[model samples]
Target: MSVRIDITGLTAERIHFAPSPLAEMGAALHALAEPAHHPGVQGWTTSVSACLDPCLADRMCEADFLWRTTFSDVFTPSAGLPGLHTLPGATLGEELDLLDKLSDEQFVDAALEFTCQSEYARRDVARLDDPRARERALELAAARGSHQVRFTQRLLEDPPAIRAWFRELMQDCDEAFFSDVWGRVRHQLVADARLKTDLLRRKGVADALSAVSGSVSLDDSGRSVVVDKISVGHTETGSGSLVLIPTSLGRPHLWVLHRKDWQPLITYPISSPGLTAPTSVEQLTLRMSALAHPVRMRLCRHLARGSYTTGELADAHGMTAPEISRHLSVLKKAGLITTRRHGRYAQHQLDLSVVSRLGGDFIEGVLR
Candidate 1:
């Protein structure tokens, strides 16, 4: 499933880049909720989580029912938020104030809209008033579990309580750990946004979008930005603008929020800061060293045609099984080969993409 945004009438002026502290807070909460999705930040997540109040952590766990695909959409400053003008990017206080100001009815409506969108791809305002639609949405929410269904029911039944609960969660989160997390990552986020702006100026929107993530690309018409997502929908950017946000905590996932009547937004992963010339050179050197051995080079040539077991490779290369195993371990660690087990046999094969990228990777490293 994917979301296609038509950029036919959009321009450089229509595109903006910024970092949102509220958004980062939501992402941090999400990482705490689903640690498996963010293996890169496990240490950070654990350290921060350990510092939280036990009661507050329990409250956060209770709130996980709202995380259908990610941190609850209701908690995020989506495009539909009444006055979430992210052009300048709001401070955490500013965004929380915006949330605090939403009237009971408005907050309820937003919660319902997010609920409907999580189950169905569309977020029709009319669905809020449709009793049948609400029931059906609740029914689909059941697939996630009774806990989520009950959570949505409570949200619909007691908007004021849910709103207050959500608000307190954010406030406590800021006090507990997210404030410091933001302080630590704010500079990196700003640097990424600036880098994106420069890329947009030099290469145009498509390339800039590509820089955001490999999952973003243009359709054949060159008028739409296709984002790979689990839910499918289409949005036309008639006169609406687009906002691109950079986040250090939102690693390994790209999130897109689109609405027919508001500006669309995308939160993409921050590029690795460790992608320095030294690191690149080290990787190239490692892969080269792995293949530098005569036996290893011969193994690569043989594996290129097809996979072979350790015993087969040893016999073919006039070596012992242990010798072939040691050489395979080196190739595997360098990411030049892959091993898969089939019953009692483990087959080794060359990874063609890594092999083919060797020259380009070396040149890119040197230039960097």
Candidate 2:
């Protein structure tokens, strides 16, 4: 299953490429929370962990819900989250200032949306429209985990207090380590945004969507964007726009935020020296070398038509299964193909986006 974005009538103006400090901050926090998920930044993570204040680290650990689930919806482009909804601030401090100025009414509505984790709870909260309903929602959320009980309670009783509390946590996080990390990666993020924007302007919507992430693909009709995600859902950007927010911290994870009366926002990873530059000189060489083989080139051409299993590819190429598997492994290592399981069989398909970016990557790598 995949998340399909229906872009049947979206114009170039309706598609936006926003480089956001707020998004990067959120991504950095997520990486901090789950360092194991981002293996490439282990060195940076180690240094930052050493620099992090003990109390700040403890507080972040306590707010596991914020990073683990939908509780951080306040930071997303939800109609309830005012001043921060799809607004790409120039700096994290600017975003924090907007968060600091959040009105009581706005905080209550946004916190309410986040606190009600389930549709049934949200419906009851809306239907009842009472303090008790809000309390019930908090209790349900608290019952799910002990970590966020006090925070959700504060959300129910004193919205401003909870807001201030999280604001302080965010501030401490910024002061402790994220600011340094942001300074290091900000330029690369902007460059990636500029690259995608250029692709959008020059190549139109299909290529533009393809440039978002390796997992994102535009269907043949050019009306739908197929995103490879664990959770299966369909979102249609009817009159709303599609907002692309680039982050340098959260590699290999694409986060989507869609809410009523707000544009659909996707926070995708674009780490420096990877998306913005070559991972290594060896990567360019590997990609070139993988396709240089005549058999592998023909294999890629066959897979371009459709996906195939090892035996099927062997049969088509008149090679043994072992030989074809070896060839496929080289292509896979170079990020030229993706393998997916179909029942008991593993089927491989060409990753067109990665292949398409090779020429540009080569040019940038060579010039640099």
Candidate 3:
């Protein structure tokens, strides 16, 4: 199961892996499989299905080149963080020269607006399964005049309600829901992979910065990651114009451009550039580290969708109540997530900011 293949369009009847050369050429990939990095081993199986069996070796070579030219260039210097590979620290304090380059007119509508709308779209999706979420989505849709389909608006307005409806529709949705959602996102990701621009147009970075702006000052851990603000403005045609390049502290070579031929404004997170980019590095690290614990990690992963109580977490993760409580205590302490008192039950929900940070990094790391 480590490898998957679908060579339907290719002339090859079967694909074979050159064990020695392939393994030797892919040490970085193997390194990525280390438990300390990405937990799911399947995430590291960099497989490619080619049409011609004869070209399998060549394809593997190409895959190796891609892995090197991409992941290694970004991830290595970040020092084993699974998310965004840390950019070079040496380039710190570099003046945000891109702002100077931009003539006054080029900077129009704030990039924050688009990033906010996009982030809202994502958050809006999460509530799709919940009835309450659906209602909220509809309200927002009405307010914003998104005019998405009424049903779509409903789904968007009340995610919790919609999610509950979806569960009822699908019946026994937990198992199938993840697969379906993953398929949706992965399919879109794979399809987008065909174009080079898809890698750079990472909508998540802007979203992360939007969330970060909520913070007044980031802690020491947050300081390690630099996020420079990009001056965004509206164009005469009524579209967003990003005057600066958006970047991650861990990534190099990959800078956020305007998705067009605009000037590339390279910037850093000297102090969280904006609200989307939270000064919660300490919270992030602490939360991730707390989740790193096998029991809690499994619990969090298992509960990615539905709400779960302490008992469910304990039962699912194979830990005692006391131990689970300890982990939960750490998680809440780190502000990675929170617990709500629901009558006799206490439910845990992952903080959206933390989720955005991790998600933003994951998107940046993989897409880049």
Per-residue C-alpha lDDT of model 1 across residues 1-368, encoded as one tens digit per residue: 56788889788877878888877887888788777677789998888778889999878776665552464444444454454343533677777666656565555555555544554335454434778766876886687677668777887667777877787887888988988888899998888888889989999888898888766777778899987654566776666667888888776667776644545778877888653222234457779899889989999999999999999999999999999999999999888998899999999999997898787665433322
Superposed by TM-score, candidate 1 places the C-alpha of residue 166 at a distance from the truth, in angstroms, of 1.1
**Model 1 Cα shift for residue 59 (angstroms):** 1.3
Q: Predicted candidate 3: what Cα RMSD to the true structure?
A: 26.2
Q: List the residue pairs that clash in candidate 1.
A: none
Compare the candidates by lDDT and give the number of the best one: 1
lDDT ranking of the models: 1, 2, 3
Best by TM-score: 1
Candidate 2 segments exceeding 4 Å error: 69-71, 77-86, 100-116, 119-124, 271-368
Q: What is the Cα-based TM-score of model 2?
A: 0.67
The 0-to-1 C-alpha lDDT of every candidate, in the order given, reads: 0.73, 0.70, 0.34
TM-score of each: 0.69, 0.67, 0.27
Candidate 3 overall lDDT versus native: 0.34
Across residues 104-195, which tens digit of lDDT does each residue of candidate 3 receive?
Answer: 21211111112113331012233435566445545544543343334344434444443344223222221322233333333332232222
For model 1 the TM-score comes to 0.69
Q: Rank the candidates by TM-score, best first.
A: 1, 2, 3
Worst 10-residue lDDT window for candidate 2 reads 119-128
In model 2, the Cα lDDT at residue 236 comes to 71
